[model samples]
Target chain A: MIQTLEQISTIAEMRVHIKEARRQGKTIGMVPTMGYLHEGHLSLARAAKENCDVVVMSIFVNPLQFGPNEDFERYPRDIERDRELARSAGVDFLFTPEVSEMYPKPMLTNVSVSHVTELLCGKSRPGHFDGVATVVTKLFQIVQPDYAFFGQKDAQQVAVVSQMVADLSMPVQIVPCPIVREADGLAMSSRNVYLTPEEREEALVLSRSLKQAEAWLYEGVALRDIQERMIAMISEMPLAAIEYVEVLRYPDLVPVEQPTPGESIIVALAVRFGKTRLIDNLITSI
Target chain B: MIQTLEQISTIAEMRVHIKEARRQGKTIGMVPTMGYLHEGHLSLARAAKENCDVVVMSIFVNPLQFGPNEDFERYPRDIERDRELARSAGVDFLFTPEVSEMYPKPMLTNVSVSHVTELLCGKSRPGHFDGVATVVTKLFQIVQPDYAFFGQKDAQQVAVVSQMVADLSMPVQIVPCPIVREADGLAMSSRNVYLTPEEREEALVLSRSLKQAEAWLYEGVALRDIQERMIAMISEMPLAAIEYVEVLRYPDLVPVEQPTPGESIIVALAVRFGKTRLIDNLITSI
Candidate 1:
C-alpha cells in the first residue's frame, strides 16, 4: 500500500518524511512532475522504483516554469486519479504541494546554464530554463533523494539539469529514462489529451519525422540532408506548425555537423497542434 | 576529547564525515573560514556548538574570492597551529580541502545578487562578490549543515551570503555571530598577521572612530556629523590610509542617512594599515 503525504507544505515536513525513510535504511528515488499522470510520467516512477528502495513522486504544476500565455491554468491535473496510478506504479510516497506552499514569496534567485540553455525550448520561451532550474533546485533541497529520475522526452531539460548538477556539484545522481511512446510512435504527453482527433493525427508527424531522421542516420545519410527532410515532412502536415527540427549532441545538446561514432545523437522537434504545443525527441548512439 | 577530522584532502571525504553526523540524528553546524584562525573564527565555531550537535569548520582560503593582484599566494596559512586550536575549541570536523579539490576545472557558473551587492567591498573588488557567492554556494552544497555560521567581521560577506541563501531558498539557516575583537578593539582577521607593529597599533583607529560614531548616535547626533568625525579620526592615524567610511543599515550593509528606530545601524570603515587592508564595524540600534 502506498502512503499519501498530506499537506507536506514546508521543508520541515518533507525532511521529516525523508528522515523516517533514511532511518529504515531506504534508498529514496524522486520523480518530480507537473501533475498529469501520462504513461511517460509513470515510466519514470517505475524506473525510480526499480532503482531505489522507496519512490517519492512530487506533483507540482510549477507556475514559475510556465510563461504567461502558456497552458498553466489549463495544464491537466487530476490528483486523485494520478494518485491511484502512482500507487499502482509502486511509488511509496505521493507529495502534492500547492503553489503557495512551494512559493510563499516572489522568487528572486535564478540558476542558468550558459550556451546550452539558448537552444530548443529556451529559444521559444525566454526565462523558462531559469524557472526550471530554480524550481528543480528547490525540489532537490526539499526531497534530498539519492536518485532523481527525469524522462528523456524533455531532452533539453535533461541537458540543462545535468549541466546544473555537474556545475553546482549537487550530491545526487540524475537518471534520465527513455521516452515512452504510443502505438503509432507519437511520444506520450499529458497534453495529448488536449489534442482533437485531427490534431492527434498531425502530432504523429512529429515522431514520424524523428523516425525518418533516425533511419537516415543509420543509412549514413548526411546530417544536413536528414534535417532538411525532417523540416519538409513536418511542414507538410496541415495542422502542424513546426517550431524546430534539430539533430544535436546528446547530454550537451549542441548542434553537431556530423554524427561521431559512439557519440549519442538527439533528434528533437516541437510542433503546435492548434493552440497546444507539444514536444518529442528520439535519442540514438551511432 | 574532541574528534578532529584531519587529512581530508577531498570534498567527498569531507562530505562523508558531515553525512555520518547527520545520520546519527545530530544537527550539524558549519563555520566557514580561511586558515590562520583567530578569535573571530573561534567565536562563530562556539556559536555553532551552542546551537548544533556537531560543528564542522572549513579552512579553505578560497582563491576564487580573491582578485588576481590580491594576496592569493601570500595569504597566511598556519594549518598545524589552526588544527591544534580547532581540536581544543570543540570542533567535530575540520574540513581543509585543497585548491585542486575545490576547483577541479575552470568554473563557469557564478551566483550574483542584484542591488545589495553593488555597495562596499563589492564596489572595491570587481567580481569579488560573484566569487564569494560561487564558493559559498559550493560550500553550502558540500556541508549541507542545518546551520552555517559567519562572523560580523566580514559584514558585506554576511549580507551577500544571506541574500544568496534567501533568494535561492537554500535549506541551511545562516547564523551570524557578533564580531570578536582584540583587547585593544581591533577586529580579528587572518590578514591582521600582515600588519606591522606600528600599523597594528594604528588599526585601532578603525574601532575607535566607529565607537565614537556609536556614542554620537546615542547622543542623537546627525548621521552626516558622525561620518565626518569618523573620517577625520581615521585620517589622523599616520599608518591608516582611509578607504571609505559610512553609516549604514545593519546586516543589509546599505548606506543610510539617519538611523531608523529598531532598525539597527552599522558604522563601518575600511583602512589600509600600511599594505594590509582591514575592515571593522560597530552595530547600534536607535
Candidate 2:
C-alpha cells in the first residue's frame, strides 16, 4: 500500500504536525521552491529525503521577491503537477499556502544581508534578496527543519541564505545541491515554459558558454579573458540578450582578476532568451 | 542547599544547556537584559519563573542598539552583582557573552520592523529599533524559549519585538511585564546610573505629568489638550529637555486625537536629564 502525501496549507496546521514530528524524534529536511516543478526542484526534494527522516517541500512563489516590472503576475505555477512530482519523489509533506494565508496583512519585517547581497542578481534587482531572505526566514521559523536544501542553480540565493543563517546563528544547516540540467545541456528553470520554440533551442548557449569558460580556466587562461570569451560565445545566439557574464569568488561573489589556487570561483550569467530571462552558473576550483 | 545559578558565556555552551533542558521536557522562559539588574529586571525574572519550568536571563550590553553618540561605552555592567541578583530572583541560567562573542565579525544580517517603529523612541534614535530587533532575533534563536519576558517600561521596544515575533511567526510568546517604578514614581532604568542627584530629583516630573494626564483623560478631557498640559508640566522642570510627548494608540503607536472608547492608548514621553536620556509610558483604556 502506498502512503498518501500530506498537504498542509496553514502555518498553524504545519506547526502542529512539526511539533508531533519533533516529539517522535523525526529529523525534517525542507526544500523551498516557487513551484512549476522542474527536474531541479525534484533534485532538491530527493536530496532532502536522503538526509532526513521527513521531507517537507514548500511551493510558494513569494511576491516579495519580485520587482515591480518583473514576472510576478505571470510566473508559472501548476500545483496539480507539482503535487504529483512531489509524491513520486517521496516527499512526505507539501506546504502550499496561498499568498493571503502567508501574509494576512502588510509585512512590516524585513531581513537583509549587506555585502554578500551587493553583487550578482542582487546588484541588478535592488530589493530582491531582501524579499527572499524575509520569506525564507518566515518559512524556516514555520517548519523548523533540521536541514534545508537549495539548488545551486540559484547560486547567489544560496550564498545569501547561508550568510543570513550564519550571521543570525539560525539553527539549521544549508545544503547546496548541484544545478540540475536538461539532457540538452540547458539549465532547467520554471521560466523555460515562457520561451518560444526557437528561443528554447537557443537557450542552450547559456550552459555551453559556461562549459567553455570552465575548460579555459582549467587551461590557465586569465579570468578576465575567459569571462570575455564566454560573453562573446553567448552573444552569437540571435535571441540571447546577455544581462551579465563574469567570474567572481564563490559565495562572497567579490570580483577576481585571477583565481587563487585551491579556491572555488563561479562563472555565472543571466541572459534573456527573448522575453524569458534565464540564469546559469558553473563553480570550479583553481 | 541553595542552587548556584549557571553562567553561560558562549553560544555553543548555551545551546548545549538549552538542548539538555529541552530533552528533559522543560519549558524555558527567557528575560533578555543589558546587565545592571534592578527591580525592573528582577520582576521580569520572577514573572518568567512563575510561568516556566526554567528561567534564563541574559545580560549583555548590546552596542548595536546605541547610536554613535549614545551611551554604549559608558553603559553600566556588574556581572558579579548581577549573578547574585539572578540567584535571588530564581533564574536558573545567566548568559553573559562578551561583545566579541556575540558579534565575532561585523554583522551582515539586519532584522528591521517598519511603521510601528517610526514613532516613539524610533523617531528620535534612528536605526535604534533595527539594532534592537536584530540582536533580539539572535538572542531568541539562541535561547529558543517557550516564552520571553519584557519590561513594559520600554513600551516601544516591547511593541517592536511583539510585532517582529508575530510577523515572523517566531514560536515564542511575548509576555510584557508591568513597569517597576521607584517609591517616588521614577521608572527604573540601568541608565539611571548616569543621572546626577539633581537630575534624579527632577526626573520624577515625567511620571507626575503622566499621572495628571491620566486624571484629565478620566475627566473626559480631549487627548490633544491632555498632551499639551503634560508637555507644559514637564517644561516647568528646569533641567528637563523634552524629546517627544505623544498620545497614541497602544501597540500600533498610531497617533490618536482622541481615544476610542474601550480601546487602549499610551501617553508616552522621552526626556533628557542633563546627559542621561530616559523614557517612560502609561497605558490605559478609555
Candidate 3:
C-alpha cells in the first residue's frame, strides 16, 4: 500500500509530520537520499523498518554539495519511481522537499570538519563534504529521527556524518549499513544508471580493485603496496578515470600508514564511469 | 536542601547521571560554566532551575578557549565554592569533569562557525570562538539539555552559540539571560575577583559608557554619535583600556549601520580593568 504526503514545503511541515508520528509513540528512522531509488536505498528502508516504528525517507538532491562544474542539474531524480519503491520497502513516511524549501535563500552558515574533511573525496571536491555536512544536518533537524541510515557506498560520507554526530554531539545515531552491490559486484549507486554498457563494464574495476587489495592484505601485503597495486589496476581501465584512492582509518576516516590489529581500515575509491562518478569501499579489520 | 553529585570523572558517569534523571521523567537544563562561580553564573543557574526539572551545571575551565599568553593556568579554580553556589541556587546536579576526562587521549575533533564567529570577540581572540563552539558542542552532547542558559556578559558568545544551534539544528534551546551587575553597575564575572581595588573602580567605566550610550539612544541620537561618545568616555578611564565598543542587532547580533525598529540592538564593550579583561552588553529594541 502506497501512502502519499501533501508534499511538505517547509521545515515546519516536516516537524508537524514527525510530531504526529511521535505522539503515536512511534520511533522514526530517516533515510536521506538524493532521489533516484534503487536496491541500495530500499535496503536502508528495510533496515529502518526493522529498527524503527516509522521510517521517513527524504528525497532532496542537495545542490550545496555539488561544485559549479558538478552535476547538480543532471543528477538523476525520479520522484514517482522513488515513491513507489519506498512504499514497497515498507517506508511509512516519504519527505520530498523542494530545493528552495530546503535552502530558502543563499545560506551563510556551513558545518565543516578540519583534517578528516581534507582527505579522500574531500581532496578533489573542494566544498563537497561541507555541502554534505550542511544538508545532512538540516535533514536531521527536520526529520528529528531516532536513527539515520546511510549506505556504505559513500563510505567517506558515512565517516564524515559519523564524525559530525560525534563532534557536534547531535542526538541522532548514525547507522552505517554495508554496501549494497549489484550482481557484477559493482556498488549500487544512482550514477550506475548513467553508465553506458561499455562504461558499466569498466566501472567493475572499482570494486574488483578493492577486492584484490583485500586479498593482498589478507596474504600479508603492506598497506602502501596494496594501495599502489589498486591505483595501478584502476589506472589501466579505459573508462575508469580514478579521482582518489586511499587507505584510511574506518569511522574517523583519517589517512593511516599502517592499520593496527583490531582497528578497522577503509580501502575506498571514487572513479568516473563516463561522466558519472561512482564511489565504493571495502572495510576490514587489519 | 543542598544536593551534591560526587565528582564524576568520566563521560560514562556523567551520562548515567543524566539518564537516571530522565528515567525519573525529569527535564534537564544545563549551565556550562568555567569554575570560580560568581553572581553572574548563579543568575544563570537560577534561570535553569526555574525552567527545567533538573539543572546540571558543568564546571570546567575549558583550556581550548584560552590563548597561549592568556591566563588559563591562573584564571581561577574553586570547585568546592562553585558547588556550594550551584547547590544554593537549587541545582540538581553539578558535573565537574577534569580536562583529561572531557578530552580523553587522542582528541582530534573541533567545531567552528563562519562569518559570525569572525567578528567582535572572535576578531581579537583568534580561535577563541572555535574553542567555545567545540567545548559547548561537547557539553550539549554530554548533558543533553532541554534548555541551556548563558549570560549576556559575553555578548558575542551568545550570538555565536545562537548561530551554531541554528546552523547545526541542535535540539537544545539557548537561553540568553540578562547580565548580572554589581551595585555600582559593574558587570559581575568570575574574573571580577582578579581585579585590584584601583582596577575595580576603573571597571565601572565599562558599564558607565554603556549607560551613556543608552541615554543618548533614548534622546533620539544616531548610532554613530552614540558610539563616538561611548568610545570617548572609555578612552578617558586610564586603567580601562578599550578593546571594542560597537552597536549591533540584538539576538542575531549582526553589525548594523542604522537601527531598525522592532529589531533589538546591543551596545557591547570589552575593556581591561587592570590585567583582567571584562565584557558587558545592554540589549534593547530600537
Candidate 4:
C-alpha cells in the first residue's frame, strides 16, 4: 500500500514542518526538481530516504530557468503521478509551490555563479544558471535541509551548486548521484518524453558519443582528438545538430588542453534532434 | 567587569558554534559590521542582546564591498578595542575573519538586488550593494542567525537586505535599529574617523539639511521643492561638496513627486568634506 504523502504548497508551511522535525532531532534531506518524475529523480529521492530521517521532494517547474523562447510552458508536469511516486519513494513531504507562491512579487534579487556558468548549457541559455542558482538558494533557505540530493545527469548544475554551497558557506551537503539511463542507454531526462520514436532513436547518439569519447580517453587519445571524433560521429546522424561537445576539467569546467594523471575530466555534449534538445556526459580520470 | 567574548576567525569554527547554539534552542542574533566599532554598531549589538539568547557579531571589513578607489586598506581596525566593546555589549561571539579566511578563493558567486540597488550609495558605489548582499549572504549562512540587525543610518542597505531576505525566503528576520548619532547629531560611522576636525564640524550640515527637508514636508512643500531646498542648504556649506541630495519613497527608493498623507519618504544625502565622503538620511511619514 502506498502511504499518503503530505503535500505543502507554501514555503511557510514547509518551514514549520521542517522546524518541528529539526527540533525533534530528525535529519532532513531534500530533492528539488522540476516535476514529471523519472528514474533519475527517483534515484535522488531514494538516496535522500536512505540517509535522512525526513525527506522533502519539491516539484517546482521553475519558469525562471527557462529562456524566453525555451520550453517554460511546455515543461512536463504530472502532479498526481509525482505525488504517488514520491509516496512510493518515501518522501515525507512533497512541496509543490505554485509559481506565485515561490515568486509572490517581481524578483529583483539574483544569485549567479560566474566562470563555471559560462560554458555548457549556461552558454546556450543566458541567465539560465542564475535562475537555477537563485531558486536553489531559495530552496536551500526554505528547506534548510542538512543534505540535498541531485543527479549527475546535469554535471554542470551539480558543479554550480557545489561552488555556491562552498562559496556561501551554506550548511547543507550536496550529494550528486549517478545518472540513470534508459534500457537503450539514453540518459533519462524529463524532456526525453518530448522526443518522437525516430527522434529518440536519433538522440541515442548523445550517450553513444560520450561512450566513444570515454573509449578514446582509455586508449590514450588527446582530449581535442576525442572531442573532434565525438563531434564527427554525432554530426553523422541526420537529425543531430551539435550545440557543444567539450572535454573540460571537472567541477570547475575550465578548459583542459591535456588531462594529467589523477586529474578528473568531463566529456560533455549537447545536441538537438529536430526541435528537441538532449545532453549527456561521462566523467573519467587520466 | 567585562566578560571575554569568543572570537571566531574561520567559517568552519563559527558554524560549529552556531550549530551547537541552535541545537540548544538558543535564538541567535547577528550584527555584521566592518570593524572599528562605533556607537552605531554597539547599538545593533545591544539590540541583539535584548532580543536573542545568543548574540554573534561579525567584524570583517569585506574587500568585496570596497571599490578599486575606495579605502579598503585604510578602512579601520582595532581588534583589541573592538573586542572590549563587543564584550561590554553582551556579544557571545565576535567573528573577525581575515580577508583570506573569508575569501580563500576568488568568489565567483554574487548575490545582487537589481532595482533597489540602482540609487543612493549603490549608485555612487557601482558594485557596492552586490558586494554587501553577497558578503551578508555568506555571513547569514555561516551564522544562521534567527535575527540579523542593521542600523537605519545605512537605510538603503537595510532596504536592499530586507528585499533579499523577503525575495529569497531566507528564514532570518531583519531588524532595522534606529540610527545612532553623536550628541552633535552626526550619524555614527566607522568612516567618521576619517574626517578632519574642521570637516567634522562642516558635516553637521548633512543632518541640519535633512531636518530642514523634514520641516518643509510638514509645511506642505512639494517633494521636488523640498529636495531642491535641502540641496541648496547643503551647498551653502563651503566645505560640503554634495554628491546627491534627493527625496524618494522609503525602502523602494523610487522617485516621489509629492508625499501622500500615509506614504513613507526618505530624505537621504551623500556629500564630500575634502576627501572624506559621508551619508545621512531621515525617514518620515507624510
Candidate 5:
C-alpha cells in the first residue's frame, strides 16, 4: 500500500523510517532542497520517484550555505504549503530539520573539493560550495539513499558534487535531471519569489543570453567571441549585472580556449539583478 | 550458520557482500586497520564481533595519511598473518583494497575537522589529520557499517574522528575500545615492528612515563610538576627522545594548567627511538 506523505523533523525518526523502507526491499531516492518548492524542485522529486521506490526530500534552509550579507534570514519558507505540494508530487517522505537540529553545536568539519570551486559562481560567492558540499555530505549520510537527484540548472553544483561523491567513494548514484523552466524561459528558483515584475523580466536575460551563446556555437564562432557576445547581450540589459560568463569544457569546468569543430562544452553564466543572483546554463556540442 | 572469513580486494565486491549481510537483518561493525597482525588489531575485531552480527575489517595502508618523511614505504605489512589473525578473531569479511583501488587518481577532496586537529599529534604531523579524516570518510562510506571501532590508544585520533562524525552527522556510532597493550605496557602499533630488539626495550619508556604521571596524580602533584617529572623520566632514558608530553582535558585537547582535585585529563606522550616514533596515552581522574 502507498503510505500517506510522512513528515520527519529529527535525525532519529528519519533513520528509523528509512531502515523500514529498506527492509521491505524498497530502493530510496532523495531530492534535497531548501523548502520553498517550485516546478524545478518538483521535477527533481519526480525524477527521484521515477527511478526509485521511495522518495525522500529534505527541506532545509541551510544557514551555512548563505553568506553573511545574503538573504538567510529572509529566505522563503512555508512548511504547510511545501508539505501539500510535496504530497501532490508523490513524495513519500519530507525531511525538514531545524537549523539547531542540523547543527546542534557549531560545525567544525568541512568537505572541500578543489579546482572547480575556484571559478565562476565560486568567485562571486565564496565558501558557498563548501557549505553546499558539507550539508550534502550530511544529507547523504542521513538518508543513505540508493540514488540522489540534482537539477542541471546549477552546473557548477553538479560538477562539484560529482567530484565529492567520487573522491569520497560514496555509494549513492548522483543522477542529474533536466532543468524545468517557466513557460517564458526564466529558470525556476526559490529566490525567483524575491524578483519584482521588472526584475523578473530582467531575469529572463540570463537564459536568453545562454540561448544566444548556443546559436553562436552552432555558427562555429570562436570560443572567445561566444563569451564576449553573451556578455554584451546581458550588458545591453540595464538591470542585469554579469557576474561571470564562460564557455567551458564539460565535467571539468575548464575554459575552452577555442571552440573545436565538434566538441561538447558547457556555456554557463551567473547574473545579479539588484540583490538577487540568478544562474543559468546549457550544454551543447559545437 | 557462521561463515568462514571472506576476503575482498575491491570496493565493488565488498559492497555487494555487505549489502547481502544487511539484507539478512544483520548489523555491521567495521574495524579499519593497516595490514599487520597484532593483538591490538585483534582486540578491535573481537569487540566488533561481540557487539555486531557481522564484522568487517578493512586493511588498507592508506598512503595519503603518511607524510613523505614518515613511514609509508617502510610501514610493516603482513597480509597473510593479518588474514589468519582476523579469522580467529571472528572477522566475517576482510576488505583489503589496493592503494590504487582507494585512490585511482590523486584525491581532490579533503574532509577536515578544525580546533581538535590543531593540538597534540596534529602539531607534529601537518596534513596528517586531513589525510586520516579523508581516508576514514572513504572507509565509512565504503562499508556503511553500523559501528566503526577505534582504539583509545590514539586519544587525539579518537577526538578528531568523533568531531568529524559529529560535524558531518555521519550515521555510524564510533565505538572507542580500550587500549590493548603488551604484557610490558607498550601500546601496540604496526610501527612497533620497526623497533630493533634493543630499541623495543627502550620504547617501554613511552608508557612508563605515563604511568609515572598516574602515580604523581595520586600523590597530589601539580599539573606542571607532573608534566615536568614525566618529561624528566623519559629524558633520563638515553635512547628515548621526547617529541611531546601533554596533560590535557578530555573531548577538547585544552591544556590542564593545574591538576584539580577530581578532573579527568589525558596524559599523552610521543617518543622516538632511533627511526621509530611511538605514541601512548592514559586517561585518569585526578
Candidate 6:
C-alpha cells in the first residue's frame, strides 16, 4: 500500500471502484468513522492495513446515530485534516458521502436487533441503537468489505452490530479493536473535546475506580457491593456526574447477579464531564 | 447453464459454491420459494435462466411468515419431485436448507419497511411483512445473487421486499415476474392443493373479480366503486370467503379515492377456498 489514497464520495463511485478492486481479487477492510481524525481512529486504519490488501475509511457524521438533543450539528468534522491523516495512514480509499447523498428522502426502512439492544446506552437513548443499526447496515451494504472494524470503547454498539450481522448472516466479518485511552486513562472520544482542563482531570476517577473494582473481582465481592463501591468512589468527584456504572456479562450485556466459574464480566462506566459523556470498560474473567 | 443440477442444503456449502461461481465471473439469479413446484415457480426459474449464468432455487417453507392459525405444518413438500421440476426448469443449483439450518436459534433481527406495509395484506396479517423482510434479507446475504426474482401475484409482497432492498441498499436487484395463471384463470399457488375440485372452480371468482375491476379502472370509475363491485362478485361464490378486495396505488399500497391520469393501480384480492387462503392481483396503467 502506497500513499496514493483515492477519495470517493458518491455510493455509485464507491461501488464502481470496489468492483474493479474485486475483479482484481483484492481483499477489502473498512474502518467506518465520524470524521475529525483521532489516534484511536488511526489505530483502526492501521489494523485494516495489516489485514487486507485494500483499506477503505468512511468519514460521515451519521445523522441517524445522533439524537435530537445530542451533538448532531456540533459534532467535530475536519475533512482536510482527515484526508492528511488517512493518506499518511496508507488508506487506499476514503469515502465521505454528503448527508443528502446518504439520505435524500425520509428513510422508511429500519434494521433492528432485539434482546441485545434493551440494555446499556440503549436504556437512556431510546432510538440510538436503531439509528446505529440502520446506518451501520447501510454502510455495510455500501462498502461490502470482507472485514469491518469498530472500537471496543463503544462496547454496546459493537454488540448490537455483531448481533445484526450474525442474525442476518451478513457476508462480512466484524473486528473489534481494543479501546485506546489517554495516558491519564480517559477513553478517547470525539466528545472529550467538550471537557474543561479541570473536568478532564476529574474524569480520571472513572478509570481509577474501575481499576480498583478489577481488584475486587478476585476478592469475590458480591456484584451489587462492587457496583456500590465504584459508585461511592466516583461520587467523590463533584464535577463528574455518573450516568451508569455497571458490571455485566460480556457480549450478552446481561446483569450478572453473582460471580460464577469461567464467567467473564465487563466493568463499564458512563460519566459526564460537564457536557461531554465519557465511557470506558474493563473486562475480567472469574 | 448445464444439464447437471447440484443440490445444496447447508449455509457453509452454499457460501462456498456461490463464492466459486462469483469468482468465475458468473452472474447469479435466485428464485426463492416454499417448494411445491408449480408453473408459477417455473416461470421465475425460466426468467432467471434467461438473465443470469447460474440459476439458484431456494426451497424453504419459512415458519416465521405463518401465523399461529395459519397452515405452516401442512404447507407442502416433495423434495424428489421438486428436484425433478427444478432440473427440468434448468436450475443450476437447488438450495433446500432444513428449518434447523435456517433458524438454529430464535431470530432476534427483523427488517421492516413502513408506509407500504400498513395496508393490503399487511392490514390483515400483522408481523407478516416483518417476517418476509427478515427472511428475504437473510437469503440475499447468504446467496449474494446479482438478481432475485419474485412473483407479482403477491403484489404487496413484491412492494415490501423491494422497499427493504432499496432502503437497506442491498446489492441484489429484485426482478418481478409476471403472474402465471391456470387455463381456467385461477392464480397459481402452492396452497391451491388445499382446494377441492368444486371449490377450485368457485375460487376463480378471485381472478374474475380482479379482472372485472381492471376494466373499471380504465372506465374512469371511482376506485371505491371498483373495490365494492369486486367484493359483491366474490360474495356470489359461497365457497370463496372474501378477505379483502382493495384497489390501491402501485408499490405504496395506499388506497386511491378516484382514478388519476396516467397512474398505475393494482386491483388486489384475497379470498379463501375452504381452508386455504388465496391472493391475486392485476396491475394496470391508466
TM match of model 2 to true structure: 0.98
Per-chain TM-score, chain A, candidate 3: 0.95
The residue-by-residue lDDT of candidate 2 on B1-286, one tens digit each, is 6957999999999999988887777899999999999999999999999999999999988989999999999888889999999999999999999999999989999999999999889999999999999999999889989899999999999999999999899989999999999999999999998999999999999999989989998899998998889899999999999999999999899987788899898999999989999999999987
Give the range of the ten consecutive residues with the poorest summed lDDT in model 3 chain A.
Answer: A1-10
Indicate the residue-level lDDT of B275 in model 3: 83
Indicate the residue-level lDDT of B227 in model 5.
85
What are the Cα lDDT values of the candidates? 0.83, 0.92, 0.82, 0.92, 0.89, 0.88
Q: What lDDT tens digits, residue by residue, belong to model 4 across residues B1-286?
A: 6566999988889988988998898999999999899988999999999999999999989999999998998887999999999999999999999889888998989999998888889889999999999999999999999999999999999999999999999999999999988999999998999999999998998888888888889999998988888888888889989888878998899997887888899999999999788999999997
Chain A TM-score of each model, in the order shown?
A: 0.96, 0.98, 0.95, 0.98, 0.96, 0.97
For model 2, the stretches where C-alpha displacement exceeds 4 angstroms are none
Q: How many Å off is the CA of A31 in candidate 4?
A: 0.7
- Give stretches of model 4 more than 4 Å off: A1-4, B1-4
Q: Provide the lowest-lDDT 10-residue window in model 3 chain B.
A: B1-10
Chain B TM-score (model 6 vs. true structure) = 0.98
Candidate 4, CAPRI quality class derived from DockQ: high
Q: Candidates' TM-scores?
A: 0.92, 0.98, 0.90, 0.98, 0.97, 0.98
Output the better candidate (2/5) by DockQ.
Answer: 5
Screening candidate 5 with a backbone cut-off below 3 angstroms (N, C-alpha, C), the clashing residue pairs are: none
Once all C-alphas are superposed, what RMSD does model 6 give against the true structure?
Answer: 1.3
Per-residue lDDT of B228 in model 3: 83
Task: Sort candidate 6 into its docking category.
Answer: high
| A90-156: candidate 3 lDDT, tens digit per residue | 8877888788777665565666765677788888899898889888877886787889999988888
Q: What lDDT does candidate 4 reach at residue A267?
A: 92
| DockQ per model, Cα | 0.51, 0.85, 0.38, 0.89, 0.89, 0.83
